[model samples]
Target chain A: MMRALSWQSLVAVLLLLAALFQLPLANVPIAMTAPAVAWTTLILVYGFLLAGIGADTFMRSRLWRGIVLFLCAHLATVFLFTLISDENGLARPGFYVVLAACWLLAWRCVEILSGLQPRSRAGRIILALIIPAIFGAWILIIWEAVTRGLGIPFILLPPPSAVFTKLIFSLSVIAADVNQTIFKAVLAGYLMGCASGFVAAILADRFPFMRRGLLPIGNLVSALPMIGIAPIMVMWFGFDWQSKAAVVVIMTFFPMLVNTVAGLAVTSTMERDLMRTYAAGYWQTLFKLRLPAAGPFVFNALKINSTLALIGAIVAEFFGTPVVGMGFRISTEVGRMNVDMVWAEIAVAAIIGSLFYGGVALVERAVTFWHPSFRNGKA
Target chain B: MSEARGNRIIPVLVMLIAIVAIWYAGTYFMNAPFQRDLDRRAGVTRSSGDLFIATMTQPKPTLPAPHQVATNFFENTFLRKITSNRSLIYHAGVTLSSTLLGFVIGTVLGILIAVGIVHFTSLDRSLMPWIIASQTIPILALAPMIIVVLAAVNLTGLLPKALISTYLSFFPVAVGMVKGLRSPEIINLDLMHTYHASKAQTFWKLRLPASVPFLFASMKVAIAASLVGAIVGELPTGAVAGIGSKLLAGSYYSQTIDMFAALVAGSLVAVLLVTAVDVVGAIVQRRMGARPS
Candidate 1:
């Protein structure tokens, strides 16, 4: 029966048993430590997690069970944080006990969230978003707790709190980096790359010979270390956003080209014959039938390029840049051991990357609403 | 069949010629400004044809012609001893080691994670979401930090760089494996149930075989990603070895021909790695009683 429990639960239980055996929570002097704060928090955390596990096992109504588990997990987190802060910069059995119990409850909360089979599309989407958010938040919490508790050197990894603080403080600097990298380089390059690739796909499609020939070459180029060209691009375009944009263009082009060609080729002979029967011109058929059918594939490439473009722009900045870009900031700051600023830049990149990908995805869903995946309301 | 194959080959050959022609023209035009300036400085009156020829032969032109890059590639790869640091082959070897090591580590970790996620409902619920969320982050953006931090801990060299590749490769493999392992049809699973097959039997005989094609496809993606990771890994470290450093050196010294050659060498390595995987995948598929398609 215990084997059925998540690893977090098993570990938490063992830690609790060790706590009962009178292990000191930290290396602090016995007279200076209240110690009861740690033990009491551990007990409360364990109790809440146990309740969550029981709710999952015996509960019938999925929604209520989820609520109970979430509540239990959150309450456990609250107590756990209090316990952790009081015992900060110290490692002890009791400290781990609190953390382990909280983690166990989080595991149960996630289990409940994943098992939820919501009927409404809204509920399903909300659940999908919440589960991942909760998961990400848990990782942040653990990173914060462990880094603070162990007093890990900031250079190795700044606590998420410090990173957050730095993020707020350095908003302008981060904004400059984002403006230079995303707005100037990434956006310009991504548009040029995708548009050019789309045009090239049309050109290739005009010649079936070129379509077949270019397809394999496109795939090969897509898989190559295209990012290595950043240096040469910088040399050609000068040390400005244009060079980075050039790198992004090269990085993004092949994926879009390959995907677009494949997408254009998706139409069948029967479909083409039907268009012929309707007396539709080649351009008209392409625009009406084949292009619409290729929506998913086109959007797939767009989504892929969104990430590729950002990465290309940033990495290109590493080779040479105009004193202000994400890659420049990261490379320079790491040299200065300003680790928090580095984290801030990374956080900004992550948030922007997510937004860019998410924006593309939203457009895809709206544009390709007639696609079969959309019809089934599935990802 | 022979005619169809010939049709494909002939078009590719024609396209290759077109690409080279376009590349040479682009180089001439791009280097024209620099070439004309050089000629004016030398007090020489040259025709457009002379200028075009001059652009193609410049020691450090803005854009090297394809032939220049080819010559540089041949010199660096074949002329130099394979053991020498100047050899492109040696640099490629340095990068390839980390790529293969990282790919192996990533594949193992991915398969293990997939197995756990597939067998345990709880892990699937917990881990799968995190895995998807992790992808939203521009992971390679953190590569420099990863290298620097590990360097601080006195853990230098291949391990640190290889970890980056491992991180990059693991996600695709994990996502692919999970899908592959769960791909058994409902009817097939029901048949196994009627036969009283144990979980182990069902997994080995049914899920394992079913996952082979997916595994190969994901591995192709994974190995390609791994090479990219390995190349990028060498960038921030100021390492004197590897293709990335060659790229760095080329840029620093403004050696356009050499830089272009390194890029080509990187591409060659990528092509070789991908083709190896494709060949192995085909063999495995045939051995598994699957038709070639």
Candidate 2:
């Protein structure tokens, strides 16, 4: 019995206490303002959850806990939104009870999922996917509820829903920003920067003395706030995507150089001797062993540069632009007090960044499939 | 030993000279067109030697010569009052304060969170994914919004900038420290268990010491990131001072030389911050009876 007293239970107990002492859920009871169907559903879900709490450990199965959690979270969301819709009504303690209960129940679900060791491969994948989904979903729910229920000024943080609505409506605008920043500047700069860096690394490898001399400098350059050169690049190129692309190129260059050089250096003397024994020429060993081994390192630089390029291209727009870019929109929209539009741009950037990173990571997995991290199919 | 050091030093020196030479040549070529346009306007032809010197001396040459930037860097950094807005040191100090403040706050928060994650399996499972995801979401996009909103609330100045810095610097330390805290070998864990050491004792006596190197390494990365955040934070705010504002002001007025100087000073600050971390890390490592690295 003592073993069953998890943090989840303690949180639930605290939430229950809050609910018992609940003031008006809003300025008025949720029922008078909310539709019958919504309040009735919320009541049904909470009642079911309360009944489960009354039962022994809410069932010993993962599926049941997940269902209760899902139902509880969804209806609690419903309850919170219905209360929020009554715009003039201020939330009282009762609004928090639903939020707290939903969060705690989600916590319990993730905790169970954390301990889950489903024997089947497909079951494992689903479990792995569901845990993070619940965690992320709850975060959005909390953000929405607090923003709407507490009536946080929209300029401070438009609720995720409003931001999404803005996003849906402004698809054309976002697509233009994407084309200007990602498709044009980032892509051009990334390809040029990475290719040049890779070439420089290979060239430097031929001269051991130059390699030693350059490596430390390269490391230093990599660590510098390379973004500071955005203005200079803007000056050199112009007030357009070309300038942003130039910034991205310079931004991506050093990291790739440093990482690729280090990767090339990883071919130890023992490996070189083995290659020599095979009567392989310098080019042969490099292409066969060194470059293959450098794939992971090269891919690491790629991953870093992908994020760096996005940031560079966008921030460079802050300097000057042709009136269309993620950075331009964000800076302009904020001044216009179009906070929702700003957030929508941020969301688009987040999605583009994730896709770019995910794509690079996928290629890395396929290329470096022989690396130790991937050898056992580790996540 | 000296000969080996010489071998390493010579190549670097050569590379430096080569880069400078290239810079000088590049300046001549890039700025030559501008100089020709000037000469064409003035209705005079200059010899190539005279033309090269003219291009290098252009007040707003398309690409300033290395010497122009060096002189500008020197005058702003050393020849001016440190308190003056025209001084690079003044701007750097402004940027550095937020960087340090943010770095300190971020390091503390990160180390605490890392400790929690290390001790709690549930946290490790739930939080690690998000920590990684947080990094992928370019927080810089929000910098402009953060500054504006905070300004609207009358919460301007160092705090807003520091908050951005804090968010930027937090991830590296947390990620590194988590790996560090969990780095003690299984054999060491067994030894602790055999002695009946409590979790607190084990953490203090074994885990904490073991994490110092990792802490300092990530601190270096975190500090650099903090500087970047501090610098960028100033950009959207239309700030009156700081390295970022200096860059913004320079760009606005086309003070190409001042912009280059600020860029240099910013990079110098980055180098110094990283070196300071390295030195402190070394001292800490030595005090902990580790071999000098």
Candidate 3:
């Protein structure tokens, strides 16, 4: 029989010891009558710890261990919600117990997840998605409990609950901002900027003069603090999506140019000689051989520009805008002390930015399938 | 080599001339509307040459000529006292100090977190994705909130800006270092295991050394990004100092030339900062017995 002497058991024992102390869960005394949730949560966690400590060999399998640890985590999270109320602050000792319990449980979960080897493709896919989701959810839960429990001022940090509530209620505003920032400015500028850069890179490859003169200037321009150009763009294009799009264009163009140029340079002289021996015309060689080889680098630029376009659009909106945009709302809302709305806008931007980046990365994986980095099945 | 350099110079010079010509033409085109309006109000139509001159020399043209920006840059950087508020160098210093502080803090934090992630398999699975997700959030969107929140706590000036820079720059370093630390071959790791080397010794002797090149590369990106963070931080604070403020003030007053001058200064700072990191990296590599490639 196992000694139950693992770090996992050790942590459970330490938590068990800590639970015997009759300390308040928070700084302020919680309403005595409302202790049902707290008591149930505590009992569940204690029960899980006991079971984990006493479980037999079969229960020690990766799957069984993962389920037990996750159950403990769920109970502990519920305990946190109970402990962290508006009238209560974290009691140092109780907080420590909760933290240790969660850390150990999370570590156990990680161990199990890493060890488990699913044979089926669908199982692997589901497992992959579930791991990060749980991790992300735990982060949000912790954020919510700590902020709400500590009674941090809304101005400082609106609790995640409040932020989510604001987001749900303010859908119209967020939709409008996304339409303005993403659909108009980000989309337009991303296309124009990346397209122009690609064309310019191709032309530069054709002419030594253009490459010599333009690449250095492009480097200098790309390094220009993009935000600094927003105000000037506003002056030039007036207060609309036009100005924001201009900023995005300026921000994204050079990265694409530089990356594409570098991508073009990646072709080996030996490869070029082979193409020449085949008597392939310049365009034929470029399209068939050189361009295909440059897929990874070109996709790298695309991914980088995807994020840049979003940022440029949002930051440019800070300078000037007409009525609706993410940056406009953020800038204006903060002035009115509508901090929740600012957070809501930030949430919207974060979600959209992630989606935009993910979309590009998905495309990259498909297009650059032959690249060595993608060949490992790791992605 | 010299002949190749000469050949490159001629094309580059020709391209430079072409760009200048384009700039002059763009300036004339952009400023023509204003110039034509002025001429119309004055009840006199000037020749094309005179109109071009007027466009180039306009006090507050829509698009300033290259020479006008040069003059503005020269006047701000060289003509003014370094201590003066109008001086570009003074503003750059303010921005640079915050950026440097933030970059240093970020580098340390990044290295520490990278070490944690590499050592703790749990962190690798759990925290790595969050770290990447954190960056995709466009922290600049939250800059105003950060500034206001910090101000509520009576923390102002460089600290808040530095905090923003830290948020930005730490990611690149952490990601880079994770790759670096994991870069050591399995054979090398097996050797360490056979030697019965402790974790700390293995880390110090093998992983840390392997991570040096990655750390420097990340630092270069981080430093440049930290400057962007500093500049963005300066924007919302409405501060009376820094390059960001200069851009803001210039925008408020429609001083396009002044804004362009600040842009030039910011770019120069970025280039210099990156080069500085590269130089230090080369020196470190040499001292570490890595040949200069």
CA lDDT of every candidate: 0.86, 0.85, 0.84
Best by DockQ: 2
Error of 2 at B291 (Å): 1.0
Lowest summed lDDT across 10 adjacent residues in model 3 chain A is found at: A51-60
Error of 3 at B62 (Å): 1.2
lDDT of 2 by residue, A161-217 (tens): 989999999999999988988899999999999999888888889888778778878
**Which sections of candidate 1 miss by over 4 Å?**
A1-14, A22-62, A86-88, A377-379
lDDT of 3 by residue, B178-235 (tens): 9999999999999999999999999999999999999999999899889999999999
lDDT of 1 by residue, A138-157 (tens): 88888987887787888999
Backbone steric clashes in candidate 3, count: 1
When just chain B is superposed on the true chain B, each candidate scores a TM-score of 0.97, 0.98, 0.97
Q: How large is the C-alpha RMSD of every model relative to the true structure?
A: 2.8, 2.2, 2.5
Q: DockQ scores for all the models shown?
A: 0.70, 0.75, 0.68
Estimate the TM-score for candidate 1.
0.94
Model 3 agreement with the true structure over A1-379: per-residue lDDT tens digits:
4544667657767886875684555554644555565666567656765664554223646677777767766666665566555463454566657555665666667667756788998977776766777778877776776666666777887877888899999898899989998999999999999999999999999987789878877776666576689999999999999999898888888999998988998999999999999999999999999889888888988888888888888888888899999999999999999998999899888998888888988888888887878776664
Arrange candidates, best lDDT first: 1, 2, 3
CAPRI-style class, candidate 1: medium
